[model samples]
Target: MNLKGKNVLVTGSEGFIGSHLTEKLVEIGAKVTALVQYNSFNSWGWIDTFDKNIKENINIVTGDVREYDSVKRIVKGQDVVFHLAALIAIPYSYLSPMAYVKTNVQGTTNVLEACREYDVEKIIHTSTSETYGTALYVPIDEKHPLQGQSPYSASKIAADKMAESYYRSFNLPIATIRPFNTYGPRQSARAVIPTIISQVLAGKREIKLGSLSPTRDFNYVKDTAEAFIKIAESDKTIGEVINAGSNSEISIGDLAHKIIRIIGEDVKIICDKERIRPEKSEVNRLWADNTKIKQLTEWTPKYSLEEGLTETVDWIKNNMEYFKTDIYNV
Candidate 1:
């Protein structure tokens, strides 16, 4: 499945990881149709920030994945479809559970059906590590039992199941890339790494944060993007749910401190009650067992935490205006 000159549709191309993946797809010479969520402002989000050459290579479409007609229209004539569109904020998901269900679950179904209808050569479905809540054992693998602790994770679980059913029932060429906590440039403040970076770069010494004990397996955004490409290129990945992670674990507290150290900032960590998840909803641990992806595809994390954090600090330092350091970005 060489993507070179192939018709590829990247839904949610305006988003953080989506934007990066879109860039990588373009780099690999894929004929990309980037689907940005239609808005009144006609904004392309991160795609607008791309250089002229990158933007020129893309066929940008304004559409919503939750709308079947919109997805169908965009999914048409595409050889490969990468479905990344979804409502990803955990706190926001708690406030509006139905929105998560509609956007994440229903939106994914729309992608599967459209891909099946279009006879797309391959369909790469985006997934999150949150689906394996509070990992029951170390180095969680694909076989780990899923526990949806948050509405956001539950929605993703439903979406993953939908993709699975499409693979089994419809025999659709679908693969799920379940990435861990991916962080890098263009990431919104809703994520912990961005929240810490945005505040520190905003000259805030007292960092307001949520529960810090929960450990996560963080992978660089670029690495995660490459994982998608690797999975898409491998025939063995069809109907597989593979984990893309660094095979390393770091607590939220440690991650924050690492970022602060990278920025050479003297910061105080404050556990802001408003930012904390409910006791029962917090996922206490996650460590990826990336053996499947490594064995199945030529994918390995290219950036270490320190290296990735340094790059993120540099990016957020210059792009501080995009974040509101004073507000808890739910």
Candidate 2:
């Protein structure tokens, strides 16, 4: 599973975590085919932000994962595949659940089937902590029961199960990497960390947020990217669902306060009604039991929460133009 000269296809290379993963793969001498979600603008999103040398190492393909032909075509001749393309906005999923099913579920099926057809070396299916919902127990393990509290989480749950079935039935060299809340540079404003960072950077007196009591285990983007590489390089990870987390967590209110302290901003926290999820659908807590990934691979988080958040705040402050600080995104 050495990636020194292997061809790796990253399905959502234009995204936040995927962009970081692509850079990490290229650093280790992997030939990367970056599949960005095709758009009329012809933009590569965050991938475009990478340095010239890194961009040169990548072969960019504009394609839609929902289209089997496009997915199949890009997946060809690739030694490894990292499937990450999907509609990831939770609130938007509530409004358009069918879009989630079409992209997350059907798109994953297409990738799995294509991998089986091509006999690829390995395929790492990207997953989320949302699939585990509000964690039935603290430091939730992979065995924790999945409860779909939101449409987005439900879609991911279905996608995870589909990946499992593929391994059991076709015996595909597929492993699922479920990352917790990953935050860093180039992160879209839809995520909570970015939301707070952008507002604080904008010098807003009142920071608008949803429910403040929900807890989340946030992993740094760089750490999460390394975990993907580590998992893919280990034969023990095949057909296994591995977690990428710090095995630590913070309540949303506490996280916000920490960020405020880092940013040195005196902003009042305001509970925005429009920003909140439905009462029954909110994920109340999440903490990762990263024991499985530890047992399977040489992967562990290298960044502390404060260190990661400080870096994230600095990045957001410098790139304030990318965020709509006044708008509540989805």
Candidate 3:
């Protein structure tokens, strides 16, 4: 399962975590094919931020994951398929649940079917901690019951179940890597980390946010990407749902204050109702038990929250134009 010479296809290569994973795979000598969502601009999203040398090493494919034909065409001849594409904004999911279904659930089905048909060596299915919803128990593990508190979470739950069924019914060599709230460089403003960083860097005196009371286990993006590679290379991870996290928790309120303190900014915290999820849809707490991944693969989070946040702030400060701090991004 060594990735040194493996042919790897990453479905969401244009995204936040996906772009980072694609770069890591290329660094380790994997033949990487990055499947970017098709757009007339031919944009590669965050992958465009990579240096010329690294960008030149990747084979970029543009197609819609919702279409089986397009997915099958790209999946052919690949040794491992890393399915990371999905519509992840929880608020947007309430307005367009069907889109989430098509991209998340149906998109996963397309990858699974293609892998089964092509006899790919292995499949690494990306998952989110949102599938577990609010923590009924602390330090949620793979065995925790899933609660779909939002349409977005529900779509991911469906997608995760699909991956499990593929492993059971078709015997596809698939491993589900469920990562907690991953944050760091290149993260979209739709996420809290970027939102806070963007506003503070934009010289705003007040930071707007939603549900500061809700807590999450945040993992650095690089660590999360490494976990994907580790899981794909481990024989023990096949047919398993593993977690990638720091096994730590932080509330949005405290997290925001920390960022403000880090930036040495005098800013007021404003709770924006429009940015908030429905009362019941908001996940009150999420803390990961990363023991399974630690046991299965030589994977551990290397970045501390403070270190990761410093890097993220620096990135956002340099890329401030890419984000619009005035409006809430769903």
Model 3 per-residue lDDT tens digits across residues 1-330? 899989999999999999999999999999999999999998999888899999999999999999999999999999999999999988899999999999999999999999999999999999899999899998999999999999899999999999999999989999999999999988889999999989988989988999899999998899999999999999999999998989999999999999998888899999998988888888999999999999999799999999999889988888898899998888
lDDT tens readout by residue for model 2, 1-330: 799999999998999989999999999999999999889999999888899999998999999989999988988899999998888999999899999999999999999999999999999999999998888898999988988988889889999999999999989999999999999999989999999999988989999999999999999999999999999999999989988889998999999999999988789999999989999899999999999999999688899999999889888878999999888888
Residues 186-265, candidate 1: write the lDDT tens digits.
99999999999888888887999999999999999999999999999999999999999989899999999988888888
Q: Which residue segments of model 2 deviate by more than 4 Å?
A: none
Q: How does residue 217 of candidate 1 score in lDDT? A: 95
- Give the Cα lDDT of each candidate: 0.94, 0.92, 0.94
For every model shown, the clashing-pair count is 0, 0, 0
Prediction 2 TM-score vs. true: 0.99
Q: Against the true structure, candidate 3 has what lDDT? A: 0.94
Report the lDDT of model 3 for residue 187: 89
Query: How does candidate 3 fare on TM-score?
Result: 0.99
Model 2 per-residue lDDT at 324: 98
For model 3, which pairs clash? none
